[model samples]
Structures are given as structure tokens and as C-alpha cells.
Target chain A: MSLETLSENRSFGGTQGVYRHKSQATGTDMTFGLFMPELAEHARVPVLWYLSGLTCTHENAMTKAAAQQLCADAGIAIVFPDTSPRGDDVADDEAYDLGKGAGFYVNATQDPWKPHFQMWHYIVHELPELLGDNFAVDRDRMGITGHSMGGHGALTIAMTHPERYKSVSAFAPIANPTESDWGRKQLGAYLGSDESAWRAHDSTVLMTEKGYPGEILIDQGSSDQFLDLLKPESLAHAMMARRQSGQFRMQPGYDHSYFFVQTFMNDHVMWHTERLI
Target chain B: MSLETLSENRSFGGTQGVYRHKSQATGTDMTFGLFMPELAEHARVPVLWYLSGLTCTHENAMTKAAAQQLCADAGIAIVFPDTSPRGDDVADDEAYDLGKGAGFYVNATQDPWKPHFQMWHYIVHELPELLGDNFAVDRDRMGITGHSMGGHGALTIAMTHPERYKSVSAFAPIANPTESDWGRKQLGAYLGSDESAWRAHDSTVLMTEKGYPGEILIDQGSSDQFLDLLKPESLAHAMMARRQSGQFRMQPGYDHSYFFVQTFMNDHVMWHTERLI
Candidate 1:
């Protein structure tokens, strides 16, 4: 419980806060943003976790997504966790897709990354425990969503722990990471060159094979510059094949940016709120 | 006419764009953000100008203020101009308040700043003319609002050109800039040792002496760290003395960040929209 409060602001009748903690899973100090709406004092509330994509920290979604007002209106707390474990001692790469800001939400099995690139453990085990112990988080009614690489994380994580998360959603998410260039490169680097090891992390694979009955939503931008890298259609195909009741939307003229996310963020918040409640 | 597009994104049924142009007034290439809500292909719309604070660029309000959706809903455009003219050749100071990003929205009369620090001309004349010439702008229906130093700018500009601006608003403005530490330092540096000359730029003086008969609104945070420097109470006193038609509110527990502005942004947008319409 070595957590520290960094800054807190009153936003939309809610508390927008940034905090730092000594993370056990990554062996590095981690920072995250939490937006908790005005609730009855000491009331436990359902929380939705939002994972950011490449070259993003907790600040990007927390500041740019315009999510607080919508989330506050929906009566849910939203969390923005850093994309990767970061520090001077932590391993990094010159490439934006593989380095500190690109965690890929997986435990690194390869050397030069194994020591500190353990975001899977940090997100699934360490961060949740921290929130549950320190904040008014209702552990039984938690939801998950993310953008891009974080989208892949949300799907795999929700499928992996179907009982832990109540609902899932994403914005321009990487649906079939095993088949995506971005996913294949990061997976090869973090989980070794074995393609079989990546199947467990791919949402298409999970939906087709080990499906979850919980609520699911995915919004992808039709005009996204990285559309091919996301391969959301592949996941849509898998969802159809497995009869997974997931909402898949291809938003036209929207790109892969917070602008696109902010436009549809209210829907996601409302969706999660209804399901969690 | 020397304008260039930097970037553009579709947001909340509008277009968020960044543009650059060689500014004759500042003698520098200036950048600004413009959010044009969806309109009939060639329909002109009312515009609300938002001036940023010290050490800030157009990006702060464009990305963080949560202004677009509200503006789009209200059928108004919003412009975010940088705090000051910026370039390697432009004079700058070590202090956050005095140099590049702290133009005080005044045309400098002093050396080293006079040549390039013509933000007053740039903002009030050059930018507006450019906007009117290039965009779907309804020149007759313009409103202005800003935060911190930019608040001071909005008040003074609207009062100086009351016939030009249909509505005016501010957030945590330095009311009496001549009496404020940040304002005195910045104004003194930019306009020289003539304290009497600074009266033209002081919002409190403008409100008290040359009253703005149009719609006026001010939202100040009580918990702002720089509350002493802002002196919203002074403006409230001036409003009372002059019988000015202004709505002034002290928001409790809110700070001077975008958090406060965003919390009340919808109200501002609606207020301006009614008057402009």
C-alpha cells in the first residue's frame, strides 16, 4: 500500500486524481489517473478501467477523451493506467511500438524485457488490489475497456477472467493481435518467437474458442490510418462464428485518435454502467 | 492569406483543426486551433474565441477544455489562439510569465518585445480578419471567453470593442492586472514602466469605467492557487459599482486548471449561444 497522491482536481462534480505507487509486479514506480464521481460517502461503486495505446500514458485519455462528464453522469468511476512499466532501469527500445510506452499488456518472457515488462501481472493482479484496498471500488462489478493495444488487453483479460469483469468495450482496438503486424512484432519480442504463445492473447482466438457470455462492445474507426494493423473485421468474424453477443461498430470518417474516442465515449460509459449495475 | 493547415480531426460532429500562418502583426509564424461545428456546406456561424493562459499554446484548450461537443451542440465555433508569438528569433524570458507564451494580449511598446510582441493586434485584428476571410464565420455574432491571463484579455477586448463582441465571459481572470503580481510583471515588461498605460488593459478598470453593455459572465474558482492574483472579488465590486449586467460566480473547491473551466464550459457555451443567436 505504498501509494502516493500526486494531484486531484474537482471535475464535473467528480474527483480527477493522479497517483503514484510502488508497483510490485514491474519493480518500478507506476502512475495512473482515476476519476471518481460524487457518490454517497464511503459508497462502493462499480469501476471501469481504460487502457491507453502506444505513445500514451495515463494523461492522454484522462485529459483528452472528455470521459469524466459522461462517466460522472453514468455513476461509474473510470481508471486510466499507464501503458507500460517505465524507469531508467527498465528496458526500452528505439521503436515506439516496443519500448516503454508500448507495454502490449503482457508479461515479457524474453530477456532484456522480462525484468520489468510485466504489465499483465501489474494490471490484472497488482493494480486491482490497490484500487480495491484504497478506493471505493466494488470488486464484483468491475468493467474493462481500452484503446488500440489496450483494446487487445481488455478482450484477452476479460476472456481470461470472465468472472472478474462484468463488461468489456474498446475504441479502435486491435482485435486479432496474433495476426496483426503490431501484435506479432510486440508478441514475438515479449513472449518469444512462438506464434502459439500469442493465441492466448488474441481476442479473435478467445472469442472463437473460449467465449465469454458477458457484455462486449467494440468501436473501430473506418478512416483509421492504422486500420490494417487493428484487423477488427477478423474479430467480428470470430464473434459471428462463436455467436458472441458483442457490439461491433465501424464508425465512418473517424480516425484513430482521442477525437474519435470522445465522440463515442458516452455510449461506452453508459453501456458499461448499465451492464455493471 | 498565408495560412496553412497543420492537422484536422472530426470531433463531436465538427472539425477540429490546427493551422499556421505568417502573422504580420507579430512578424512570426503563429499557430492556432479552430473547431468548426457541422454546418450547411457554406453556412456562416457564430464564433467564440478562447484565449489560453501563460505557458500555453492553442493545444491546451483544444485538447483539454472539453469545449467542442458543447459548442457543436450550441451551433457556435470556438477558436484557441496561442498565448504569444513564438519563434527562435523572437525574444523570450526565463520566467514563465513574461516572455514567449506570456504576451499579456497587449501590443508591446518596449524594446526587444515591440517588434514581435503585437499579440493585441494579432488577436483582435489579424486573426479575426483572417478567420472571417477564410472560414464560415458570422462576423456580426462573435463572443469571447478565456482562462487566467487570457481571461484578462477577453474582458478588456470585449469592453474595448463592445460593439464587435456579442457576448463575453472569463474563468479566474486577473481582474485588476495593474495591482496583480503576475499582471504587473508581465504588463510592466511588455508595455514599459508607465503604470497609467496599463489601465487600458486592466479588466476591472474597463468594467468599472468603460462598461460593456452586452452579456457578461465570469466563473472564478475559490480554491485557485493564484486566487490572490486573480481578485475576482474586485471585478464583482466593479460590476456592482457600475451596475454592469454580468453574472459572477465563485465556484467552491475548484482550482485554476482546465478542470474548473471544463466543469463549467457547457454553461459558458450556452450563455454565449443565447446572446449570439
Candidate 2:
């Protein structure tokens, strides 16, 4: 429950704080970066949680997204958590997408990973609870957004717990991880061979089964290398089948990289702010 | 002088291009990232050259600085060159500061570094030539900025060739390297023990010797761990002695890190835009 202030600096007329806390779920110290707007002095601000993708830590979203200015303008606080629990003792995979950098925002039930890879619990329960207690965040006005796999995490998490998130969006998210190679490999290893369980975490399936009341905004790049694996069409089909009010837009000549994310990040922050307000 | 386009993507309603070229200076394939605003289609835009500090490649500023939106808003293009030349044939030192990451933005006269450490020629001359030929950048309207050691680069380069740079700024820059441990170590190794020759690259000394007609803007964090080494007062004194209009602000409770850079980056972009326009 104790948090260590690793580093704190003032940026863009806002305060950026990096904190480390021993996670009860992961059994390791986890680090996250938060940007609190200057407006926080007047009243509690809406919170936006950003999940990063493969080969990324909390630092990626914190540094690269270029989201703070818009968040500051919109009077929103942003939190960035490590992609996964990491330590010399913590288990890791040689592959970039399976281990330390790839939490996939799922509660792993598999061996070696079950103990420290409870990212679902970390993001949804532990992180929000911690932020609410320490920072002046409007818990009821929380929103979520992310890049790539983190996009998938935001979509799935928000869809599953609509009451917990007032808004949700993604940048080049893996729409149907249940059908993608990354999804099949990660979900199989983390949740076992049960295809039924995978559906619970697949944003497309979640959209069809339990429609989100609020609009689900997604931006996918046409040039993204992972387009074959992301399959945004599946989510589009699911939304249409369910008569979902969410909007899924495919951006032209973009990729599944930070360049794409940074380009559209302000719009995402603005979108979340509109809903949070 | 054929450039190989490594990657290109659209985001935040702009184009991010990564390119590599076999440098006649560094004698290796050097990489740089450029962000072109949508406004470039209609008119040639002012350019901001961002030089990174120690242990950073072009990737650091490209991924971490979060300057693209501000650049886009200001209708400015950002060019980030790799910190130093790197290849199997390139000479290197075990220390992070000296060998690969420490080009020092000077034409090295020493043996091992002389051949491949031509960052001065690369950035000041060759880069502008290439940008003029290949990109929609107004060569006549350009500005420079950097962080830490790169701050030193921005100041020295702009002052030395005021014709090339219309404005200049830095974030937690090492104001007077001649008086700092990092600068002395790098200068001694790269430029030899000739203390007089070092003045050409020392911003404070350059300000006193060759006064800049325009104002210089700098933001230094009061809590920066390297404040003792940075010596902002030395630079301030030199600027004052020369009667140069410079804005040197010491921000309270900040540090010499990217968090500090991202916080005030918009101001730098806006500063350059004002001068460029």
C-alpha cells in the first residue's frame, strides 16, 4: 500500500510524477507515471488510463504519446502502468510479446505466469483503487485508451466493466485477439485451450455479446504491419451485428507504431474529456 | 546522396518519416526522424532541429520528446539526427559518454574519432542541404533546440552561425561545458587539450565573444541533479555582460529528465515559430 515517489517533475504547466509500489497481485514492485494537470488545484479531475503495447513499459506511453497537453487542456489526469511485472526473479520469455513486456491485460492462470502476470487485476482493480486513494481523481469519471495490444486491453476491459469506465478508445488495437496469432498464442498460454474463455477477452466478441452503452471509438492505421493480425473488421462486424453505437475508423497510410499514436493522441484525449465531462 | 526511406506513417493528422543515408561524414548509415505537418502541402514550413544528449540516438528525441503536435500546431517540422555514428567499423569506447553516443556536435580532430565523428558537418551543413533537397522545409527560416548536452549543441551552433538559425532554446542544458566535468572530459578527448579551441563550442563563451542579435530562451529545472555541472549562472552572466536579450528561467521542483523536457517543449516550439514566422 506504500508508494515511493521515484521521480517528480513539472512539465507543460503540469506535474508529472513517477511512482513505484509493491504490488500485492504481482508480488513485485511496479512502476507507473501520472500527469496531474494544474487544474487539480481547483477540483478533482477525470482520470484516463493508458495501456501500452508489446516491447513497451509504462515509460513508452508516458513519454511518446504526446497526450499530456490535451489532457491538461481538458482537465484530465493520465496514468501509465508498466506493461507487465518485471524483475530479475520474475519470469520472462525470450519472445518480446509473451513475457515481461506483454501482460495482455489478462489474469494469467498458467504456470510461472499466474503469480506475477495478473495484469487484469492490476489495471482494473489495484491501479484504479491506488489512484483514487492517492490522487484527486474522479473514480466515477474514469476513461481508458491504449496502443496495439494495450488497445485490446482497454477495449476488452471497458466493455466487460462499462460501469467502471465512462469512455473507451484505442489506437491500432488488435480487434479480435481470439482470431489473431498474438491472441491465440497469449490467450492459449495464459487462459488455456478453452476458446470459450478467449471470447471473454476478445473485444469483438464482447461487443456482440454485451454491447457497450457508450460509443467505442477506435482508430486503426491502413499501413500497420499487424493489420492482418488486428482484424478490425471482425470488431466492425460484431458492432454492426449488435447494432452498437461505437465508431471504428481506419486511418489512411498509418502503422501500428507510436508515430501513429502520437499523431492521433490529442483527439483521443479530447474524446475522453468530452465523455468524462 | 540517395536516401533510403526506412518507414513512414501518418498520425495526429501528420506524416512521420524515418530515413537512413550512408553519411560521407560519419562513414556509416545514419538515421533520422522527421515529422512533417499537414500544412507543409500548402507552404514550406519552418524547421526545428532537435539534438539529443548523451546515450541517446535519434530515436530518443523522436519517441520521447512529445513535440510533434506542438510542431504541427506551430506549422514547424522537426528533424532529429542520431547522436553519433555507429557501425561495426566505427570506433567506440566502453563508456557511454565518450564513444558512440558522444559526438559532442563537433568535428573531432583526434585519431579514432576524427574519421567518423563529423557530427558538426553532418548536422550544420549536410543535414540542411539534404532537408532542402528532399523535404518541404524553408532553409532560410530555421531554429534549433536540444536537451542537456544537446542544449550545448543548440546554443553553440546557433550563435556560431546565426544566419542559419533564426532562434534558439534548450531544456536543462549544460550551459558552460568548459566548467563542467562532462564537457571537459568530452572536449579534452575530442578536441585535444587546447582550452582556447573549446570556447568555439562553449555557449557561454560564444555569447560573450560573438553576441547573438536575438533573444535566447532557456528553461532549467531548479532541482536538476546536474545543476552544479550545468552552471546556468555562468551563461546568464555572459549573456548579461554582452547585453544580449536572453530569457533564462529556473523552474522550481523539476529535474533534468524527459519529463521536464515534455512539460515545457510546447513553449520552445512556439518560441521558434514566433521567430520563424
Candidate 3:
């Protein structure tokens, strides 16, 4: 697919750019942020995918994550896909939690959303191909991470496609979305009342049932306003029940904002870089 | 004056807080971002003031500048002041370069802006006192830096109050605003037609007339669209004519954006911290 360069800026010794492309999976014009480190100019580098939380465009993590310096040092290229498909014609709900910016990184099976909310196929399949074909990215050494809703996407996507991403991590992720109110409402709307269908997209359920071979890293803020809805503890319990290796850290005095994400961004980038290398 | 804590978040082992208080100089409620390094709780740490460019709120640098981690490591408390006074009651112009978001960091001596555009007094006098009284900041060990219009403000303010700020630097600053269109338009409206008043606010003119003590650092991006209007070379020439110690660097691929500011933010913070220590 042909991509349009929306804007580009020199940031942290890298080219931080935004691009627009016609996506087959989403059936819409999708935009994503791509940051190419100076090292990418000379050789292919390990690529990391960052999915943003609800109500965020590609700009949120691009502007707020503070990950470029670390990624530059690690010689990694990071791509940030928008949370959901956007545009006037796309089906959107008035509430922020259900539509537009809240794709939940799943292929919708319901009407009004199924037509344009195939973010699962978009991020997992189409986006990586587009980046590999157009940019200096090594498809073999890919890693994935995100915050909140995007975190759910990261875990489930990584769990289901272990061969695609070498490392996986998240910040304040909605671990057991099938059990939480946020997850129930979104899953109910998009996947209908079939509880079993929701289990495939739920990280906690995926971990207990499918079990990831690699250790998954997660950072949960104790002060997150949506901590109850996130239910990170449930994921920990599931990992323990399955005897799966996972690292879950509860950060004190932090919240469910970019401020929290940026504080530990260095650690996440380095974690992925070490594994990718 | 009592300050209302608008919001606070933990960032980079520091508290990134926004506060609002009634300002006597601007005759309005002014808000500023205060990043209190963890060291500040134990000691009165050195303070660094960051003035943003035109059409930016204090939040721009807070989110985009990516300076917190560096500042935190350097044990410096950074404060970001809004570009101009804002509110419904305050006087404003439709044009972005004038009125509300473009206070020019000077005391307005003309109509429509005189009452609430006294950013000069607000930054130099009232802001320092407020920070000192409300936070753990060392008034004697302070530094100032900015970008574009804010860079002009930093140069002039630091030049005039050399005893207050220990070090000064700017990124893509309008060095000789009096000689540039943006400067001429803003200075004319704020300081009236008296060209003499404009000289004090122009860094090039000020350096030539009253040379700054110690060294000043400036970084100008070669690809900056407003390079002609900024005239960093003019200031370099004036500094040389006066035998003033100033270092001016032209970055090759950078532009006039927060990306450029964040690129060199570490160098600037370390530069200021070295002098402060």
C-alpha cells in the first residue's frame, strides 16, 4: 500500500514522522507515527510497536511517551498505530469508551463496527507488512507494548502471535478485560454476549489457557483511577495458576496517565531491545 | 497569594504539578507548570525557568519538551510559564501573534493589552516570589531558557537581571526581534512606537548596548522556517562586537518545533546545572 507523509520532525537524533495510508483491514484511511532512529539510515533495525490507550490518536504516545531517546540509543524503530479507525464516515459511538478511539485492538464481529473496526487485523497483519515494505525495519526482531486498552491489545496480540514479537510489555493494562466492567461493556458491544469469544481477546484468559513461553512484563500504577477495572491482580493470579513466567510490578504513587508511562519508558524500551538483540 | 493546585502527576521521579494564582502584574489568574525534582523535598534545589514559544500553553513543554528526566537527573526544578495570559475576561486578538497567546514577554505600554499583558513583571518579579514561597527553590541559583518568542524573553530577561539567573540559553530565539517582523509587530503594540523601548527587549540590541556578563548559549536550527526572522547571526555579531562570551550553534536538520527543543534539552539542562552547582 502507498503511504502519504503527513509530517516529520527531527527528534532525539531521529526522524519522528506521521504517515497516512489506505488500510485494507480497517477499510479506512489510517494514520500512524513512525520514528526512525539515525541508525536506521545505514541498516535495518529492530522494530517495536506501541499501541496507544483509549481516546488517543497516534499523536499521544508520539508527543507524551518520551521513548525516542531510549529507542535511539537502543537502535530500534518504534511505530505507533492510532487506537481506532477515524473519519466522518466511520461508525462512531457518542461515548468515548465504545467507539472511534476505542478499537480495543479487536476485529469486531458486530454491525456498525465490523465494517471499519478491524484493528486486530490492521495492527497484527497490515501494519507490520506496510512498515517492512516501506521502512528500514526488521520483521524478524519485532516487539510490542502499550498502555491501558493498547496494553490489552499488546498482550493478546503477542500471546496469539509469539513468533511475530520477541518481547512483550504493558503499562497500566486492562489485564482481564472479559471480567472488568470496561471489558464487559466493550466486548458485549463488539463481540456480543458470547462470553467464550471474549476469552480469546482477554489477556488473563489467554495466559491461563494458551500460556506464553516468554516472560511478559507489566507495570501497574497503584494509584490508577481505573485500577479496579484494570484488574491486573487477576492476570498475576492466572499466570501463577498456569505456572507461567511473568513480571508484574505495582508502582507506588503513580496514576493511569502518560506521566506514569513516560517514567518507565526507558526500562520498557531497553527490555525489548535486549530481547530483540 | 494562595495558589490552587490545578493538577499534579509523578513524572521522572519528580512531581509535575500545575498551579494557578492571581497575578498582580497581569491582573489575571496565571497558571504555570512546576516540576519539583525529588531532591527538592530535601534541599532547596536550583530552579530553571522555561518560557514556551507563541501559541503554546504551559502544557506544551510539560508534555513535548521531554526535559523532566534530564532535569530530574541534574537535580534541578524546572518551571514552565504560559506564553501569555489567558481567560475570557482578558483582552485578546484574533491573530495568533498578538493579544492572548503572544504577550511577547514584555509589559504592554499600549491600549487593549496594557492591563493584562505585563508578562515582563509577572516573570521577573511575581513568579519568582511565588515559586520561592510555595516551593523548595533556591532563588539565588536560577537559570532561564526558552524557544522562539520565549527565547527572546529568556535572553532579554536574563540580560537585564544577570544577578538573578546564573546561566542563560535559547533555542531558535528571535534574537533581534526589533529588527524582525514578528518582533516589530509585537514590540510596537506592547512598547509603543518608541524604538528605544524596543531595544531593551531585543537581544541583539541589548547585547550590543549592554553586554551580558558570563557566557550565553544559543542553538538555531538551519532548517527552521523562521530563520530569516530570527537572525541568530545578528546576535552573534553583536556579542562579538561587545566581546561578550556567547556560543551560537546552528543545527543542520532541525526545525522550529518542540522536537528541536527536546533534542538539545539535555545539553541545555546540564549547562545550566553545571553553572548552578
Cα displacement (Å) at residue A215, model 1: 42
lDDT of 1 by residue, B1-277 (tens): 7789999999888899999999999998999999999972458999999998988999999999999999888888999999998989999999888888899999999988999999999989999999999999898999999999999999999999988899999988888889889788888888999899999999988877887876477777656888778876577656633445545665656789999999999989998999997
**On residues A1-277, what C-alpha lDDT tens digit does candidate 2 reach at each position?**
8999999988778889999999998899999999999998788999999999988988998898888888888899999989999999888889988989998999999887888999999999998999989988889999999988999999999999999999999887888898889799999888888888889899888887897877777777756788778876677556544545554555656778888999989889988999998
Which segments of model 3 are wrong by more than 4 Å?
B1-277
In order, the B-chain TM-scores come to 0.98, 0.98, 0.98
Residue A75 of model 1, lDDT score? 77
lDDT tens per residue, model 2, B1-277: 8999999988467888999998887788999999999999888999999999999998898888899998888888999988899988888889988979888899999878888999999999988999999999999999999998899999999999999999998887778899889799888888889888888989989987886767687777767788778877677556533445555556656788899999989889988999998
Clashing pairs in 3: none
DockQ of 3: 0.01
* TM-scores of the models, in the order given: 0.51, 0.51, 0.51
> What's the lDDT for candidate 2?
0.86
* Model 1 agreement with the true structure over A144-220: per-residue lDDT tens digits: 99999889899899999989899998888888888888899899999999889988889989988987776577777
